[model samples]
Target: MARFLLRRLVTSVVVLFGLGVVTFLMTQVLPGDPARAAAGRNATAEQVAAAASRLGLDRPLWDQFAAYFGRLFQGDLGTSVVTRRPVLDDIAQALPSSVELVLAAMLINVAIAVPLGVYAAHRRGRFADVAARVIVLLGAAVPVFWLGLVLQLVFADRLGMLPLTGQLGFGREVPEITGMTSVDALLSGDLPAFGDAVSHLVLPALTLAAAFIAVVARTVRSSMITVLDSDYVTLARATGASERRVVIRHGLRNALVPVSTIIGMQLGWMLGSTVLVESVFGRTGIGAYAVTAVLQNDLYAVIGTVLVIGVVFVLVNIVVDLVQLWLNPRLRQPARGAAPAPAASLAPGAAAEAGPAVKEGAVS
Candidate 1:
C-alpha cells in the first residue's frame, strides 16, 4: 500500500510538471502583448518598450520562461501585469469563493444524485427509472450559463424568494472569517448573514450541481444494477435479510466504487465549470479572476490559475485511485500471489449458483 501510494504521488508530480509546461507555452504563444495591454492604446512606442522591459518581456522568450519557472519553484507566482498585485495573493483572495461554490455544488449533487440513483435502480424498468433517465438527459443537455440565468429569473425575479446576485445584501457587511461566506457568517455568530449567504448560493449551486448530478446518478444507477444481480445479493435474499438492508448495506456499498470515481471526476469539472456559473451569477471567485486575466492578457495570472487547476485535477485523480484500491481488495492484492480457490466452490447442501461471482468487493 505504501509503495502504491508513493508511486501515485510521484506520477501526480510528473503530471503537474507537464501541465505547468503546457500552461507556460500556451500563455506565451497567445497573441497580443501583456505589456501593451497593460499600457493601454494611448501609450507611445517608448512607453510600451519601457513597460515590456520592466516586465522582462523584452528578454528572450526562453529566458522569460526559465525565469517564470524559477520563480514558480520558489513559490512566487509573479506580479499581475494588470493589477500589479502578487499572483499568489490574488489567488489566495479569490480561492475561497471558488472552493465554496464547488463544495456547495458537490453537496447538492450528492444529495440529489444518490437518492435518485438508488430509487431508479430499485425501480428498474418502471416509470420511476424512465423519469430519472429523462431528468438526467435534460440536466446533461442544458448549458450551465443558461441554467443559471433561468434559475435567476425564476427564483429571484419571478418568485422573489432570493436575492438576484451578490454574496450578501447591499450594505450588510458579513465578517470574513474563512473567506467562505456561509462558513464565515456562521463563525461570526450571525444567523441572518449565514441565511443570506446560503440563500444567495442556492441558484448558482443548483446550476452547477445539475450537470454533475446527472453524471453521478447515471454512474450510480449502472453500478447498483450490476451489484444487485450478484451472488451475494441472492444469498442475502435467501437468508431472509430485509430488502432495505440488503439493498442499502450490501448493494450500495459494492456499487459505490464506480460512483466514487464519477464523483471525483465531477468535482474537478465543477472547479472548471464554476467560471461560467460565477460570471452569470456575478460571484467573486477564481473563475471571475481568470476571466479578467484572460481579457487583459495577464499571462502570469492566467498561467497561475491554470497551474492551480491542473494540480487540483492531478490530485483528485490520485485520490480516486487510492479510494478505488481501498474499496476493491482484489486491486490492492498481488495478483500472482493469491491463494487457490477451494476444490468445491460452494457447499454440497447449498442451492445451485444463483448468480455470477462479483470480482470487486464493497466500497467503504
Candidate 2:
C-alpha cells in the first residue's frame, strides 16, 4: 500500500509539472502584450513597462516561470489583472458550484449505470444489451451544449417546470459556508431552500450526467461479461452459490480496477463539459469563471484557474487508484503471493514427497 501510494504521488507530481509548463507556454503564445492590455490603451509605454515589471512579465521566461510556481506553492494565485482580486480568492468563491455540480452528476451517473449495466451484461446479445450499446453511442455522439439547450427547452420552456437559470431565486438565501446551496439549506434547516436548490439543479445535473451514464454502463457491461466467464465465477455457480452472490462477490468485485479507471477518466470529461453546462444554466462556477477570465484576457486568472483544475484532475485519479488498490490488493502484491492452498504447508521437497491426500485435495 505504501509503495503504491508513493508511486502515485510521484506520478501526480510529474503530471502537474507538465501541466504547469503547458499552461505557461499557452499564456506566452497569446496575441498582444498582456501588461499593455492590462494597463489599457491610454497608459503610456512607461506605465506598461512598470506594470510588466511588477507582474514579473518583463523577466526572462525561466525566471518568470520559477517565480509564478514559487508563489503558487504559497497559495498565491496572483491578483487578476481584470478583477484586481487574487485569483485564488475568485476560485475559492466559484469552485464550490463546480464541485457540487460534478459530485451530484457522478452520483446520478452511478445510480443509473450500475443496474442497467448488470442487466445488460446478463442479457448480452439480447434486446437489453443492444439498447445499452445504443444508449452509449448516443451519449458519446451528442454534444453537451446541444443537450443542455434541449433540456432547458423541454423542461423549462415547454413544461414551465424546473428553474431555467441561476443556482437560486428571490428570497432564498442559504448560508453558503460549504459552497453547496442544497447542503447549506439542509444545514440551516431550510427545507424550502433545499427543494428550490434541487429543482434548479435537476436539469443541469441530468444533462451533465447523461453523457457519463452511457459510458459507465457500457464499461461496466463489458467488464461484467469478461469477469462472468472467469474460473472463480463458474466455480461459485458450481458450488450452488446464489446467482446474486456469485455475480456480485466474485465477478463485480474483481472488475473494480477497470471500472474505476473509466470513472476517473470521466472526471476529465465532466470538468470540460462544465464550461458549457454552467454557461447554459447561468451558474456561477469555475467553468463560467474561466470563460469570463479569458474574455477579459486575464493572464494570471486563466493560468491560476487552469492549474487548479489540473490539480483537481490529478487528485481525483489518485483517489480512484487508491480505491482500486483497496478493492484488489493483489494489484499491489506479487502474483505468487496469492495461494489457493492457504492451509497446506509445503516442505523443501514437498512436490516429490506429496502423496494421495495432497494430490486428492489439490485435484478437488
Q: Please report the candidate that would top lDDT against the real structure.
A: 1
Residue 357 displacement (Å), model 1: 16
* Each candidate: RMSD: 5.1, 5.0
lDDT of 1 by residue, 1-364 (tens): 9899899888888887788788778757888777786567679899899888877888998998887788778878877877889888998899899999999999999999988899999999999999998998799899989888998999999999988988888877778878999999999999998999999999999999998888889888888898788766776677566889778877887788888888888878888887898999999999999999988778778888888877788888889998988776667766675564632232221223322322222221
Extract clashing residue pairs from model 2. none
Question: Which residue runs of candidate 1 sit more than 4 Å off their true CA positions?
Answer: 38-41, 339-364
Model 2 segments beyond 4 Å from truth? 335-364
Q: Give the count of colliding residue pairs in each prediction.
A: 0, 0
Instruction: Give residue 66's lDDT in candidate 1 (0 to 100).
Output: 88
TM-score of 1: 0.89
TM-score of each: 0.89, 0.90
Question: In candidate 2, what are the lDDT values of residues 312-332, reduced to their tens digit?
Answer: 889989998888877765576
